[model samples]
Target chain A: MKGLVIVIGRDLRLALRQSADAWLAVLFFVLTATLFPFGVGPEAATLRQIAPGVIWVVALLAVLLSLERLFLADFEDGSLEQLLLSPLPLEVAVLGKVAAHWLTTGLPLIAAAPLLALLFHMEPAGLLTLLLAMLLGTPVLSLIGAVGAALTLGARRGGVLIPLLVLPLYIPPLIFGVGATESALSGLSARPDLLLLGALLLVMLLVAPLAAAAALRQALE
Target chain B: MHRFANPARFTRIADRVLPFVAVATAAALGVGFYMALFVAPPDYQQGESVRIMYVHVPSAWMAMFIYVAIAVASAVALIWRHPLADLAAKASSPIGAGFAFLTLVTGSLWGRPMWGTWWEWDGRLTSMLILFFLYLGHMALMHAFDDQQRGYRAAAILALVGVINIPIIKFSVDWWATLHQPASVFRLDGPTIHPSMLWPLLITAVGFKLYYVTVVLLRIKSELIAARLRALDLARLKAS
Candidate 1:
């Protein structure tokens, strides 16, 4: 537990020191969301209807953009080897890294989601649902993206490879997240969608770190 | 099972089995196509366009089945570190991708006449598309590393992660189809499907499975030979 906290704190401090790295995801999220209106035309009703999907999709892409750097820095600087050699279980260390990733990237995406929702003229209930859905969804993204990041460690063209690997896995969350917001927009019960998102988050939380640690072990070997 | 893990023994057994599998595949497919096109009655609603189901449904089945096979093989490779298992998993992917592609194309062909568009964001089609993407990712990841073993292990891990998506694709498509459109054009699960139609579908499905087995065996054989050639080249380099 102590080791996990220390690892998380170390990653969090590093991320905070290079704050631009975190903001870049947020900026991309906002910019991409802004472009959808232009591409689809500036009609309000259409934007309002498509808002949930557009937001979720761009948020997915933004999360993917930051995933490459998750393990690359440590792997490059040789600290990943030291961490592997440490007494802390590699899974715990992985959980910490994933947590830091969620904090730096997922948290910011969630924070920025509402502003983009507002720009798309989302209603108050829909905006809140979007926020809630993102809160549950983005952690799942970080967790799964951790596995992709770890698997692609030292691989060629990992940046291009990560999205291809991760986006297909992101479909369920994307469906449920957008479903929740769209439900709220239409005055339907969003509970089922939110519950599904929560279930997916819990499942990913359990599975992803172990898989990532295993991938890390393979890469290290 | 463990005995067959030996590649030389497996190859010996597979070489004997391949001819049988090939003959069975050809026979089944020949009969199945004849049955599907000539014997089975056209749908009262869809007319002759219903023939596409024989190819589309079976290809879709192979698409999912191959992914499951890959996942199981990957699990064995990761847990037991069986090199043959790794090769089997890697060899199966492109075949799976091909099946997925055929599913999409035939589906689009059916849809153009039936659904009035070449594509629809309909759940089953979208899920199959995603499955295709997953196969592509697996193939890309398998070749990404310079080290063969490293690439195998990484791709194996990815295969396991992707196995979760299969169920989601199945259920989401089912649920989405049910919610948005109550009666799909083709109803395979309904009691209304006649045995004549059913038998041809079953035969074609079995044929596709046999074809998968035949090709995968050939691929693994080639992969083993390739590995041997590489070893010989390395040894020759060392001697020089």
Candidate 2:
């Protein structure tokens, strides 16, 4: 636990030093949301209706964009080797990395989501659901994306391959993520989708890190 | 399984079996097409358009069938580290993807005539589309790594993870109301299709299954030879 915390702190401190990375994610989130209005026309009614789905999609993508970089820098710098060799259980260290990743990318996106929501004229409930889904969904994304990143560590064109490899698995989350927000906007109960999202998160939280750790060991060897 | 896992053993056995498999495949395909195209009675509702099912349904069955093969092979590779299991996983992917592609094309054809559109967001079609994408992803991941062994291992893991999609695709039509026709071949009490059309559809499905087996075996043999050549090349380099 102590070692995991130290790694998390080290990762967070380094991430904060590069302000552009975080801001670029925000820029993408906003720009992607804005493009939809133009593509589908700027009519307020359409934006208002599609707002929840649109915001959820962009938020998911924004989270995905930064996820590859989770272990990438460390993997390159050889810190990942240290982490693997450390006394701390690889899974705990993995959880720490996922936590730090979500802190830098997912949390900020959750914070920025409501602003995007208002631009699209979303209901407060939908905004709430969007934030909620992001909170649960992004950690799983980080975890699952870690496995993808680890598996593709030495693969050529990993950048292109990661999303293709990961996105179909990403669908279950997207289904429930968008579904939850859509329900919230309509003032219907969204618990089923939310629960399913949580269930997926729980499962990935358990399984993905183990998978990631194994892949990481193989890549390093 | 381990005895056959040896590539030399596999090649010897497969080389002898290939000709017989090829002959049977050609014969079955001819008989199946004959039954489907010439002998089958027209559907009262779908008329001639129903003929699409003889092609589409079998490909759909093969699509799902091949993934299960992949999943089983991956399990064997991961648990037992069987070289042939790894080869089977690699060999099965393209055949499955082709079957999926056929399913989509024939489905779209059937949908256009029956539903007055090229496509619909029906449960069965959408889930199958996702399955197709999964196959593409698996194949891409398999070749992504510079190291052949690592790529194979990662791809095996991917195949196992992707087994989840198979059930989802199968049940999607049942779980949700879909514009695509409901299950006609395998059902609770009996098949929904009449006897005349049923015979052709069943025969075609067998033919497609035989075709899948033939292709997968050929692909695996080729991959084994390629791997052997690579090993020999590395050894030659070392000796020099």
Candidate 3:
């Protein structure tokens, strides 16, 4: 238990000390979101029409960009090897890492999202739904992305490969996230989509750690 | 089963079954197509356009069927650590993707006549398209690693998780209001399709299944041989 906490603490501290990375992830999110209005056009109505999807898509990309960093840094620096060798169960360690990853990458994106939602002229309801959806959804991304990250450990061109391996799996969350916000904006009940997103998060919370641990074992082997 | 879990043993078994399965698949395909094209009566409503249903529905059936097969094989590989099971799962992906592509193409072809548009965000069609993309992603992930075995294992877990999406795809139209046609052949009640059209659809579906079994077995055999050649090379390297 202490070991898992230490792992989480270590990840959090490392993220804190290396403030540049957090800033960069935030920058990536903002820059990407800013680009969406331009790509889709400056018309407020049009932006509002596509806001939910645009925010979700950019959020997905931001999460993807940071995910490889989750395990790659540890694995390359030999810390991951040491972590595996510890008496602590790898699954516990994985959960801690995932939590830390979500804190660093996922939470910031949610905080930054409301501002971007404003750019899209998204309704206040759309913004609230987006935040709720992101809160539930992005941790699932970190959890599942951990699997891809662990799998690609030590593989050639893994940086390129992780997104290819992980993005298809990302589809479900993108669906629920956009759906929740769109439903909210359209005055339909967002409850079903919110419930579905929660269900997805619950599933990832259970499944991803074990799967990621197994992949880590294989990668380290 | 454990004793025969060896790649060599798997190859031997696959070799013995390959010829028979191939022959059976060929016979089924021949008879199934004949029945579909020649024996099956024109639909009272759809007419010649109904022919697409023969190919489309069967391929759609295979797409979902093969994904479940892949998931099962993946579970076996992950749990029992069966060597050949991973190959079976990996080897089956491209074939499944092919079936998915066929489903999409034939669906689009059929759509043009019926819906009067090439594509729409209809529930059933959109979900099927997503399923197809998932297959493509699976195959891409398999080759993503230089260590092919590791990639296989990773992809196996992915294939297992992705199975959850299958039911969502299957029931999408029912769950949501979409422009796509509702289930006609498989429903709570008897098939809505006419008996004249029903027989060929079922026959073609079976034919496609047998065809899948045949091709997947062949792919597994090739994978086993490839593993053999890898082992021999490793042995030679050690000896040198």
Give the number of the best model, judged by lDDT: 1
True contacts kept of 1: 0.71
Q: What is the C-alpha lDDT profile of model 2 across A108-174, one tens digit per residue?
A: 8888988888898877767778889888877877777887777888788988888887876776676
Q: lDDT of model 2 at residue A119?
A: 91
Q: Write the per-residue lDDT of candidate 3 for residues A22-75, one digit (tens) a residue.
A: 878889988988987668789988989988888888888888999878888888
DockQ for model 2?
Answer: 0.44
True contacts kept of 2: 0.43
Top candidate (DockQ): 1
> Backbone clash tally for model 3?
0
For every candidate, C-alpha RMSD to the true structure in Å: 1.5, 3.1, 3.0
**Per-residue lDDT of B1-240 in model 1, one digit per residue for the tens?**
678878789889999999999999999999999999999999988899999999999999999999999999999998888889999999999999999999999999999999898997777888899999999999999999999899999999999989975786567566555656755654456777889899999999999999999999999999988988999999999999
Off by over 4 Å in 3: B168-190, B231-240
Q: Is candidate 2 or candidate 3 better by TM-score?
A: 2
True contacts kept of each: 0.71, 0.43, 0.39
What level of docking quality does candidate 2 show?
acceptable
TM-score of 3: 0.91
Per-model DockQ: 0.77, 0.44, 0.43
lDDT of 3 by residue, B1-240 (tens): 578687777778878988888888888788878888999987666678878888988898888888898999898988888887888888889998899899889888877877777775566667777788778778877887787888888788778767864564345334443322464422213656677778788888888998898888888878777777889999999999
Instruction: Show the lowest summed lDDT stretch of 10 residues, model 3 chain B.
Output: B179-188
